[model samples]
Each structure stands twice: as structure tokens, then as C-alpha cells.
Target: MRKIYVIGIGAGDPDHLTLQAAKAIGRTDVFFLLDKGETKQSLVDLRERMIRGYSTPRRRIVEGRDPDRDRAPADYTGTIADWRTRRSQVIEDLIAEHLKDEETGSFLVWGDPSLYDSTIAILDEILGRGAITFEYEVIPGVSSVSALAAKHRIGLNRVGQPFQVTTGRRLAEGWPEGADDVVVMLDAQQAFTGHPDAEIYWGAYLGTEDELLASGRVADVADEILSTRAEARERHGWIMDTYLLRRHASD
Candidate 1:
């Protein structure tokens, strides 16, 4: 039997690596990285840095290209399912062909794997297929949401007020009912535009040297965020951003 560790590497900062994640790095004989492409090479670079700084000297890093998906596919769920299936096969091959029995493998996820990440789901699919067998555990790390809150010096939720965490797609439908605040993630479309009256705390490339943050009434800052996101994406070839929208009490 083989064992694997899915360890969250934190939002972006190497310092955000927890003791447990550091320990997991030491336990890994091989680390698997799913490369997202040249635009996000910084992410792959960061993973390499973590592996070098924390893992054992003799550790190995296995790189694989991530399957691409349509950004605006009509069949969103079906596309995602197919993408995951492809990714699972890649991972299964990495584990079966690369790792030896009783050896351990690890994946350094960006943010807590329990959040919006799909590594766990893909691995589960691989396990279900029975092509490979291994025991695994998750080590949570600081998420971009947490990094946003920390950088902005704001709590995710107000006292006694519930907040919803959702994607930019759902946010386009409308603000969620029953929640005074919402944390929007993976929103490339600047959905915050719809709620101009809401207050927003937005951050991009959080916890890294390139981090950009803005806050104020959505009407005031939405344009700035939009322009900034565009500039950042053009500059870095990729961008990861999250924001909090808080509707005023009177609204």
C-alpha cells in the first residue's frame, strides 16, 4: 500500500505554510504538481520554492500538465466533470507509475483543499476507479479568503450576522438571501458591479509581492477593481482574486 498527503500550501505566502504542512512535506517521497500553464508559472515557481525550502533534500517533484477547460462552455457542469476525469487519470498514472509501494506522495494545494479546490475530488475518483490504491489525508492551510480578510483587516462576518461564500457565477444571479455579507471567489467577471451600493473589500494575488487591494463603495471601487484585474491578468498572464460584498443595513 502507498500513502499520499494533500497539503494546502496556503494562499501564496511561503510563510503561511503551517507546521503540519511542513511535516507532511518531509513525509513525501514525491510531490505532484499540476501545472496550469505559462501564465500561472508563478504558482508553479512558488510550489518549487516550498518544496526546496521545506521538503527533504532527496525529495522528488513530478510535474504534469493540467487539462484545459472551456472558460465559457454552455455545459459548465459537464465540462467540469470531464476535466476532473482527465485530471484523475493523470494523477492515477503519476501515483501508479511513479510511486513505489510503501512510498508516499504529496500534493501542495493552494489554500485549504476543502475549499474550492478539486484535488481531493479527483483523487477520490481515482481511488473509486480501483486502478490505484492509497491512503490519504488533508492538511488545511490559509485560504485566499483568509488572506483577504487579514490584509484588509476585516472579519469575514459581522457579529451575529451570517455570511455566504459563493462563486462569481452565483453572484451574478443576485445576492444570496438571508446573508448580509458574501465572500465571492473565482469571479473573473467583476460581478461586484451589480451591487454598487454594497461595500467591497477586494484583493488580488494576495499574500504575494504582486498583491493588489481596494475597498470602498462598489460604485467607487468597482471600476478600479475591473481595471486593475485586467492590468494584473495582462501583466501576470493569470490572476486569482476574491472579494467581500456587504450590503448596507438600510438596503
Candidate 2:
């Protein structure tokens, strides 16, 4: 039987790749790269660059086409279900074609494979079908959450306080009931607006030389962040950012 390794490549920086992750890449027979279309071409390029820098010639690169982002349904639940289904098919096909004779193939994931990433989730479903008999291994990498905390020079969780990690959509729906510290990712609508009393430390393009950092009370910094994010996106054509929010006791 063959084994499939899902390895997290960390954020953008080559130095962020953990030793285990690098070793996994070096050992794999084939590598799968996700191409999230042209809008995110840099993401694909960055992964390629990392693989080139770290992996030996024994590993072959295979590119996977991204599902059509426009095809996503407006309904959140249905959209995710549909996307996952399509993604699983893509992976199944890729595996059959590329790894037919290989004992181990790997997929390089951005950030941590376990956090907010759907790669492992989709793969789990495919494996559950029992159509393919394969062992799975997850090589963890430094998540954007840790990168953000390090960039800001602050701990993610307050002393003796609980912290939560959530998406911008959830934050927009409403601040989670009892979180003292919240790390928000995949923010599209600037969900910080929902929390009036939180303090925020936001970073964009983390680990890259062009990173932008800002900190202030949420209410005061929210608009600035929104505007800056817009301008930054316009200038760079894309942005990957994360932020930490805390409801200060004094507020």
C-alpha cells in the first residue's frame, strides 16, 4: 500500500518550513501544488520556489487546477460541500494518474494543514470511501497565527484567559460570546466592526519583507485597516493577512 503525506509549508518565507516538513518533501516521490487561479499566482509560485529550494530531484512536481471560485453557491453550507466534492474528485484523479507506481506522494499545504484548511478535510472524505488504501501522515508547520503573534511581539492568549480562532464571517455575525482573545483569519468584510471594545493588532503579508503592521483599539483602527487593506490589495494584487483581537478589561 502507499501513503499520502499532507505537509504544511508554513506561510511564504522559506525559513518557515520546519525541518520535518523539509524532510517529508525530500522523501516524497511526487508533490501536488494547488493553483488557485491567476489571481493567486504568487501563492503557487512561492510553493514552487520553496520546493525547488528544498526538495531533491527525486521528487516530481504536479500542479492541480483550482476549482472555479465563481462556481461557489451563495449559501455557505452548500458552497463548502460542493467545493469539497469537486476538490476530492480532482485529488482522486491526480493520485490515480501520478502516483500509480509511487509508494508515497505529498501535498504541500499553506500555513497549517489542520487549521481552517480544507485540504485534509477533503482528503479524509476521499480516504473514507475506501476506494484507495493508503496511509496518511500530517507534517505540521508554523501557522499564520503563530507568525502573527511573533510579528507583533505579543502572546496570542492573555495570561489565564482563553482565546479563540475564528473566521471573519463568524466575527461579523457577532463576537464570540466569551473569548478574551480572538485570532481572525480569512476575513473578507473586516469583521472587527462587530466588536466595539476589542483591541487589535493586525499584520499583512506576514514574514515577507513588505509586511505591514498596525495596532490600536479596534474601534479606532478598524477603518484604517479596511482602507489600508484595500489599498494594499490594489497595489500588490493580493494579500494574506491575520489579526488578533482582545476585549480589554479597561474598555
Top-scoring candidate (TM-score) = 1
> Relative to the unseen true structure, what is the C-alpha lDDT of residue 248 in candidate 1, on a scale of 0 to 100?
70
| Candidate 1: segments with Cα more than 4 A from true spot | none
lDDT tens digits, residues 1-251, model 2?
77888998887677999999988887888888777778778778788887788778877888888787443247988887888889898988888788855468898888899998888888888888877767789999988889889988999887788899998888888777777788999897788877767789999888777688888897788889889999999987888899999886554
Give the per-residue lDDT digits (tens) of candidate 1, residues 179-209: 9899999897788899999999999889999
lDDT (0 to 1) per candidate: 0.91, 0.83
lDDT minimum window of 10 residues, candidate 2:
65-74
Q: RMSD of model 1, in Å?
A: 0.8
Q: Which sections of candidate 2 miss by over 4 Å?
A: 70-73
Q: Each model's TM-score, in the order given?
A: 0.98, 0.93
What clash pairs does model 2 have?
none
The TM-score measured for candidate 1 stands at 0.98
Residue range with the least summed lDDT across 10 consecutive positions in model 1: 52-61
TM-score of 2: 0.93
